[model samples]
Target: MAALCPNDFKPIGWLCRKKRYSLKWKLCISMIFVLMTSMWINPKLLMSMLTPVSEYKKQDITPVKNSKHLMVSAFKDHRINGSTRIISILNRGQLQPLFCIFCCGKNNYSTPATIDMHSDHFGFRYVTTDVLCRNKPKSNAMYVTLSLKPDVLYNLTDFLPIQNQIQEEEAFPYEFTICISSLFGSYNNVLQFVQTMEVYKLLGIQRVVIYNTSCGPDLEKVLHYYSEEGILEIVQWPIDQFLIPSRGWNFKEHGGDIHYYGQLTTLNECIYRNMYKSRYVLLNDIDEIIMPYQHANLHLLLEDLQQEHPNVGVFIIENHIFPKTQFDNSGQFNRTEWKKVPGINILEHVYREPDRKNVFNPTKILANPRQVVQTSVHSVLKNYGQTFRVPPDVCRIVHVRVPLQSNLTKEQLFVDKKLWEFEKPLLPNVDNVFKKTGFLN
Candidate 1:
């Protein structure tokens, strides 16, 4: 036979030269060749060899997923292995790392079905296709397995304005009132408290009514001044607050009048007369300050709160001991010290308002504001009084009394203990009230 050079390539010559097989290689090669040739020659044999890839996997692979059924002739007759190859994508780092496996295009079908292959391990099976997306063609025809679940993702939307508007329209029905006694001066310790309370207007408390039992003419003048200023409301009772206990009536904790329930007669009267006008009534001393950062007014705050529980919305705020530094009055023991407590803005004004600094509580809305009430520990009674929850949002009961140099609260005890307990304490500049009420006359 004439020697044929490589340039005379009839494919077989080049194949024989390049793929020179040893005996063992030829043996395996002969087997594969015989298998390929014999199967191609007999149509029935080829059909038998080309069973569904799913059958090889002991499952059924559809036209999209079956490897054996994939015709690489869909290529330019340049045949390649038709099975799918799994490529793993880099994981941003999680337990079951994500992958970027690839396979031929014609084989890949539904994304969920492909994911099932990795999760179910139904064995490798794929189809023939060009790995293309849009008009951009992949340099190599391949299928890539992207992360089924990615750590980060984005969405297109516009859905929060509706939620905001709904919240705005629903805000209403706020009602709260503050109750106190002594106007200003008689029980000087509470002067700081009165100042602190001025901040309550920002918290929904619009009106504060003072019930006076035993204030001197000076106190009346002070109250009258505030009343004219449109800030204070005064209700006068001619008797001393202390005489109630001797009359077999004790409004405070010390003296219990069996004839009348343990509650203060005045407080009981106040409840009956004003409960309807206000959704909330605060039973506090002039030395006590109720603090809340919820709303600009107590009325509006209660309305928001009423949305929480179906019943029972009264809240009892615990007392916080204020700092002694707040009471420092430059060594002055006169009524001026009691008049102001100095706010963050003014060092001279003892009655200056403090800055808001407490945390808010998560609140449940009450169904009925009328259902709430509060009682003193001294008031021996059943818990059945209409009650409400004091959400942390509006929670505060600062008893700025006792242990201060101002002899204000302690001085009152000597006057008439029962009276002091039943009625609220006084503000400091109450003498100004006397000048206004003409009580001195």
Candidate 2:
């Protein structure tokens, strides 16, 4: 062999020097090679691997403790003013501090919430409260979670998706939506429910939103029927599961934790839930129907009333009681097919009790939801415009239930068959529902 020089072993020397590089540099080169190979194999797989995990991972936070004392119901984004309104039920006397934690991708921003207990708590321990949180600029938060501490871990609270963020104008999904809140006591009343629903259709009501805690089997069938028809939306209201709900409105008399099965809370929730969806929202019970005496349909009645009271947002209609005990003399609507139904026949009860002299008669409401901030069973607590008491001749709610004035006789009551005016269309519609639901087989 020829005499060996350093030049003869140059390739092996180069390889040895390259191996002397730092481990970090070696790993970097290896990663680059793997990434390039992955890209050639599947670009989407490489892109997904490079993307942040937070972008696709669903965040599930633990539900807060002591939810009964301070239960969060819903989150609404008040797009009109760019603020968030948190619907919650809190102890009226509770002094615990609450914070609104806004979730923005991987980060969270906390803000002190201004708790506004609704004035119509009715002396109950728990009340409907509005926890208002102002949106922070550039937070880009789409959901909110409630916590007692300002610096809560993102995984410690349940996230509520913010709703009602879309601002709608003239176009709306429903012209009139009837809101029946917190149906409890295993409410059945199949015949009356069907009658009322058909009457609502006659009155031009396009939607009926009911917060149901519990109902009997017959009523459930009726609810399912209307829901399948796309005319009713049932919101599951398991208030009793969370708190001791009262049977009556007054806390002292009713003797329970929350007033009237959290009726006020459901009413206000319905208002906000349907704010941008419905043009008008009528807050009343299933047994009561806002019957118009003068106009053929509710649309015309509202059209004229809105024209007259251009600045008014709420129109309070007097509630007249049609005692279920008294029936029409003719018994014209007491059809044999309906006798088996387990509810009062509203059509048969035509005589309404005379309005008590110099006493405050509780009224139901028909309001422009866009103008209402909060609502109660009888009236709107906070509104953007004037509240007008609609004339009795124009409209009134036909409330058929246990008589408030039980002393009145049939002869003493007024003969107001306003419901009969709707019988032509109402009866057949109700019959069809009953037939379809097999209530009358």
Candidate 3:
């Protein structure tokens, strides 16, 4: 028999073996397609039947109540409008916001933020509160494992496997400098303090400006030493050069909080207006230390914040006071051997609820300084958009403000018992915590 042609009407190749069987098979396939099409017409019913069913609906946390007028949970154990364990911060009138607080995590993305992933590789849409309530979608495992990585992994993975020429400029993330002005107090170490200054240098910190404002000469000496060592710029508002009354930098003594803060405001406005424009400015006293993990510096954090949300200013800090007690006029900072690294006792305090003990005086400075015009009681006076707070682990700017090394010394803090003896009763107990401290009694 002659071999059948490839497209013979008699059937060939795939249809060659058995005409009867092939016809039956085609008939069945066509019938199945028709059935599928009919089922698809009522797709939800089909999905209910054919999709793998989970017995239990995934539990999403209770959605945040009143997101627009964000209510940072009244400090833990402190009820809103009721309990008084921690002071309730009520937004009185159309007052300017101090810092935008968020509980974050799951509920954050539950209400899909209208995003444009392609336009800028990062964008946020103006979504009305009602829109958030209506179109929120449930997220699943695939969304996280396969999706979120595209932006971060693209640059981090470096794509060395395929081609090495990916332009770093197009990388979603970019580096920015975080200038920390670690001033020295009377209690300091010359060699060791310089070594501590080296941490910022190692993490690709391009510039470090130390406000060598010390009551004694130790910190100034260290700054001078580091200045020669090419790690820092030593500038001092010496005890002699103070802006306000005598010893203006002593914030904890003799109503220094007010004077020191005023001085900080003047200095910030001056420097921010003059010499340089930094992307992230941290307004911390010498006691504040901003430590980030895995060498993921400030630029990296800001890039992530910018990626997650478009615009933001200052990052409010949650201060953790150490030793879990009132002032310790003991245990001075003693450095015996020269060149020995100054040991910092990371006095881990009792862990309180995050929103509680992690006290945020919104005014704690960290920001694009030029963007802000002035500052009020823990509030930033800004010229533009709203400020948003991010997770602390992403940025832990620690404040070691109380019972400082100075408290351990013989030199009385400018608290001058003689001067305050008469006016003690008249001083304002502005904050409840301050009222309790009695320094303003």
Candidate 4:
């Protein structure tokens, strides 16, 4: 048995045990090879198990600040007719949703606008008005904010609706400019013009904007004189050259191209025309004046009012209609020299009709050009800052027009002495303007 099994050194049971141990080692090696292949295929799955959930989340959501280079080049507040438009530029071409957040009173709502594609990196984009109502919006003192990105937001500087209505192209350098709309060739009120302008000068007004359509020969002379003086900015408003403008503001009755010879357009244009040049704008007719009762000039009056109510941008001055029917009997200022001038002497019309019950006294405004957006003949249509009803005591509109209400007599009308306070300078100033313009000669 020893000679036959000389090649084999171990017994049968020992050989069988060695073979079984060898099989166990082979199984272990095969399992390790399968595991190595699985690990190579799904390495992230193993890492996920090892890493914490919060850390993974933090790494995933890393916000890119100021990544969206959205810009606003031009903006307009069309709230006068319940519309707002924003012109912007977007650098990135991705389809990112943008929102224009309007902050007004307690309401903060966002309206979506588009960023259109263009050839240039700085493309021109537009955002139209999202108005829900036919009438004016709930608040006038409003501002704009832009939001789209997760980390970046743009808060525009506090701009009033007035500033948004037009482009600041024709700006002037005057403290105050009176915007007299639609001077439709009427030179019938020379005396009224003289008085109104004189009072304006006393009130610290530096310039007057007249949208002239036509005028009397003599009136043209005065206008030319004022124009040469660099005090009057005359805009040759040839509305008839373009459209059949309305004869009056009543479009429903006397319909035309625009109401009252494009009066609305003229007023809006005047505001934009003098937006940068003038600090304050007084919107009224040539017959009207925002007269201060307690203070001497507009500067003092505004200083006091602004100090008290700092946030108010538009001051709605109440229009006190001093009917041309009533004349001062005391003979304070002689108007015999102005008889040939062909206009009413405002100095004589000291009697104002008493405000009747349920009757609204038409109002005018002395507004901050930067604060106002849209203006009507009587009042401000839209504004950026708060509007305030100026107290009658502080200042009010001296509207020397024909009586709107009937059955009001001398006794019924109240005599306001505010005009008399400026008589010292007003009298000489009127004469000087007349003489300087060659009306007195």
Best by lDDT: 2
The order by descending lDDT is 2, 4, 1, 3
- Select the stronger candidate by lDDT from 1 and 2: 2
Colliding pairs, model 2: none
Worst 10 residues of 3 by lDDT: 155-164
Residue by residue across 104-204, what tens digits does model 4's lDDT show? 54454556654433222111121111212121355452444445632322222322232344444356468788898867756557888878887788889
Clashing residue pairs for model 3: 363-378, 424-441
- Put down candidate 3 lDDT per residue, 1-441, tens digits, no spaces: 544644434545445543345788989999889879977786554553443323111221111223212110111110112111111112123222222121122232222221111111011111111011111223211111011111221111100010111212122221233333323246554332333344344434554555444534544445554566554545443422322222333334443212332333233322232213344555554444455532345567667766776666556654433322322343321213221333242222212112333543332545655355444323454334567655555565444334433233333322111112212221221122122323123
Candidate 2's displacement at residue 175, Å, is 0.8
Q: Give each model's whole-structure lDDT.
A: 0.35, 0.81, 0.34, 0.64
> Given candidate 3, what's the lDDT at residue 150?
17
Off by over 4 Å in 2: 1-68, 75-80
Tell me the tens digit of each residue's lDDT in model 2 across 22-135.
799989999999989978987766645555433422321123455434544444555436678877788766657778888776677899988888898888898887888877
Can you give the TM-score per candidate against the true fold?
Answer: 0.37, 0.85, 0.40, 0.61
Residue 355 error, candidate 3, Å: 5.5
Off by over 4 Å in 1: 1-174, 181-185, 188-190, 193-197, 216-218, 241-263, 293-300, 323-394, 403-441
In terms of lDDT, the poorest run of 10 residues in model 1 is: 156-165
